[model samples]
Target: MESLRELFKIGFGPSSSHTMGPQRAASKIKEQYPNASRFEVELYGSLALTGKGHLTDYIIKQTLGKQTIVRFKSDRLPYHPNGMKFYVYQDEEILDTITAYSIGGGTVEYEGSKLQQTKQIYPHKNLKEIIQYIEDNGISFYDYVLNYEDEHFKAYLFEVLDSMFTCVQNGLHHEGVIPGRLQLKRVAKSMYQQAINTRRESDRERLLVSSYAYAVSEENACGNKIVTAPTCGASGILPAVLFYCYKQLEIPRKELIKALAVAGLFGNVIKHNATISGADGGCQAEVGSACAMAAAAYGWILELNNSLIEYAAEMGLEHNLGLTCDPVGGYVQIPCIERNGFGALRAIDAASYAKQLGYLRKNKVSFDSIVNVMKETGKDLNSAYKETSLGGLAKEFGLKDGD
Candidate 1:
């Protein structure tokens, strides 16, 4: 809780695990050897397994080219198998050739002769030993690092949540209209149109109705290009609640921070007790847990009651108990893109329903029990369904082949 590692991370992605993690790892290596002339990056384990489809290779190239993961655009980055390699220069002197990988969930590792370690092995790679190195050497680190002040941390969380809301609102407005290599689905487009028509309604009302629209139209919603929530694949839930509170409810920024604080609490609980990486626990841990977090946050805002917030989160977690993270062609396209809407809608519903019921009744279900159920469900799930693009909609349907 004091570290804020789980709540905040930096890196590239079509996925937090596959894309962002690798880029973060490479960036850490660059920080380690500011004066090094050359570097090489490599991937191992799960990163290498679905690295290509997840854009792990592309993310590494951008990291090495002196590009921060948070700013690189997926479309502009190179996508070859050896991935992209960058030769850097400082003051007309040739530097190093840097290589890296997108190891999912914003974790990265360095693979080169110049470096002593090949893997970025910290539990939260963004806060790895390299950050310690910077601190030890009295060098400036990235602005995103936590300063550990309650008020300051709260301010940072609110700012990130506000930015997330803005990004989603903008993304939904133009997710499909401005097309990209990834084809747009008609569902999101239709829902966006419907939302436009219903703008005059209360923000909460608009969100409740539009959540369903976006969920049904998952193929079309655009993810946050760089400054986005975890990933487009699980983006909508966090934004929907925040936007609703901001617009319809007229909730203050401080209140929004409270909601997000609650969210971080619940999210960390899951990350510590179960898993968030798709490779480990599948989509349930990602979108499902995110939905649960959002639901809990919304409940916190609505009920002004802690138990109610916990209940709402547990309900959200329980509902998505068996969800999987199977993406077609291993890319975060297909069902992956649309899944965010569903997760968001589910979170909204859970919050609303919990508000109608008393907290005591809701708490009988228990968050711990729900988490256990999720872990069990994940264990029961087929490996093909675990973001491998080998089963579920990725296989039973023609999504993999078509992609």
Candidate 2:
């Protein structure tokens, strides 16, 4: 794992892989050819298929300006699912041609660059192995993260948490129809208002979390700034759960910071062991991972022991296994925004269930095992189901290739 920084990227959303990643790639091009007269980029596979709705082209143009030429290459690349080739020209002649892959989140890999070393922050890469180390060290999982992370990590996490809440506040205040053909009415503000007025005490926490999740997801869909708890596609889950716990359960800010650390560690584990990009692993890797992260965080907040905390995280991912990346209309709207609400609700419920069951004591399955299974299942999934928008809800809604 690189750092919690890699796991939580603060950027313009809707789609992290499609928007943030491409913007980063274009930024590198601008730096390399500062005086170039022309720039061209050909988006491939998942990028090409859903780039329009994700604002991939708009982002690139915004980064590189009007001199840029863009193309949609629908054919899948051999290197990665979300691939783009960049061409820079000093005049009419091509100066350089480079290809890059937006692996996941906001990370990008250049074809000619040396491969990124999978640096191990801790000795263990999975939850099963780390739990034993935790048992021996007399330390919590968050302590394990602290042992390896920089001393300034506390400040970094504070910033991340700050950004999360800011997005929620902004999303809650903004009310209008979201962009794109769907004209999806902004429901977060209304949802929040309803939750506030509800007399059903049992529904208060659930509704609050659901509204918060919707707020964050709606912000992302509107191209507003938000933190990618794992990725922009699933940005809403962690904040919704954590904020709910802080407000409803009255957890202290310092304790919530520890919870954030725990969640980041879990996210890093998944990103290292499998994939977090829908272009590679579908929605299972994106929102599914976010749910697990939120679950573990909430479990920590609830004062669950290590075993149950892991169990909560396990249930979060297990139930969401094989969830496909089926954002309707290629826009991270319809199912994507609604999906975050469900992810938040499930995460909170999973934590409570694990605590009640004492799942760590008798559960047969392990979080590490599920991580492996998720990767295998993602590999087995068809390309169309992995953010290409060529199948599932996209196809059912009559969205064609490159739509």
Candidate 3:
């Protein structure tokens, strides 16, 4: 099976499945049809329904303009009046009259009578079909689609892992100390200060302790917050693991990439077999899956057996069972940011405990079984918690009501 690097990626904020995914698909479209003078874009299903709230439209626009999605500045985003349109580049002049949509989970499609529909084995609502009309008598169908669940190639995996490490480090240092929003109760600056004070300790120990301290403060100040995983809305978890590996274990930079690779593999498996988008599977899919990935990575870096890695991964997933994607506001602000810290702490705990318990003797949990449960649970969840901004904290707190 291919590794996880291809499945999970590091990109701009707000969303992975929503913003990043669509941009990725757009790049793929360009890749398959380079040198084309004109191109059109379209969207379908869930992407159309709640794309605006998730910033899917903006992502697609940037993608089709041949801009690099990962590094593009927020102010440079392209804007279009309609959801679909075309771009014509001739004589070094760039003219875009294209139409597109931001399907939830980062999916976008181009619309037209000439469009050719391409189907995938995976069942997802946010589908994109890019059709080009060639002069040849025979018509050709091109599918610039992304499959979240399938195993990805090694080269792709490495690229993503490398990007993720860079993103996290850049976000932490250059992003200028993530502002504390989301009623998180704890403050990023405060936590950072505490982490600094504990600099005498190993990175792993300092990160673990500081995170626990922050979680304690948050619980005391406000209440429980979900982990945002790779995002600030889902932050903390990935950073915690990365910091621990870098500081405590003193893992080399090259080995860190390997660790991330292992982590990405675990995340991709959950995404493929279950869900990673909050719109589809709730917070469990997002944060829970991230925790599971971190745990597996920790185990792998520690040189544990495959069984240990599996155990850590399963523990990470199971512990976060039934989490809901209930951000107070539609923005990835609010509870989303602080939640990452909690998830990261949990991952470390799970990894350490799994090591102590002995993977050889620990009860085995089937990945397939857990995935099935996640899918069933997501189906049973209310629409309010599924990225609709209608339930959970979004509605209960009256944040962005009528928005």
Tens-place lDDT digits, model 1, residues 174-224 = 443313334644355456566656756665375454553253224223223
TM-score (C-alpha) between model 2 and the true structure: 0.95
lDDT per residue for candidate 3 within 1-403, as digits (tens), equals 2223334434455565555656666666566556655444443333443345456566666666643222211111132111333444543576433344332223334554233333334333210111112113232111112233344444554455454444444333321322223433335445565566765666636555445424322321221221223332354466457655665567876666667656765665565556666766778877787788788778877777665667777888888878877655455555555566677777777888889987447656754567668778977887567665667777787765113
Off by over 4 Å in 2: 114-123, 359-361, 400-403
- The ten-residue window of minimal lDDT in model 3 covers 126-135
Local accuracy by lDDT, each model: 0.57, 0.88, 0.53
Best by TM-score: 2
lDDT of 2 by residue, 1-403 (tens): 6788878888898888999999988988788778999899999999998989898988999999898888998597797899999888888898888889898888888887433433556667788788898899899988888888889998888888889989988988999999888788999999999998999987876788999999999999989999988999999999998888778888877788899999999988898899999999999999999999999999998889998998999999999999999777789986898899999999989999999898446778889999999999999999889998878899888865324
Q: What is the TM-score of each candidate against the true structure?
A: 0.71, 0.95, 0.65
What lDDT, from 0 to 1, does candidate 2 have? Answer: 0.88
How far residue 319's Cα lies from its native spot in candidate 2, in Å, is 0.3
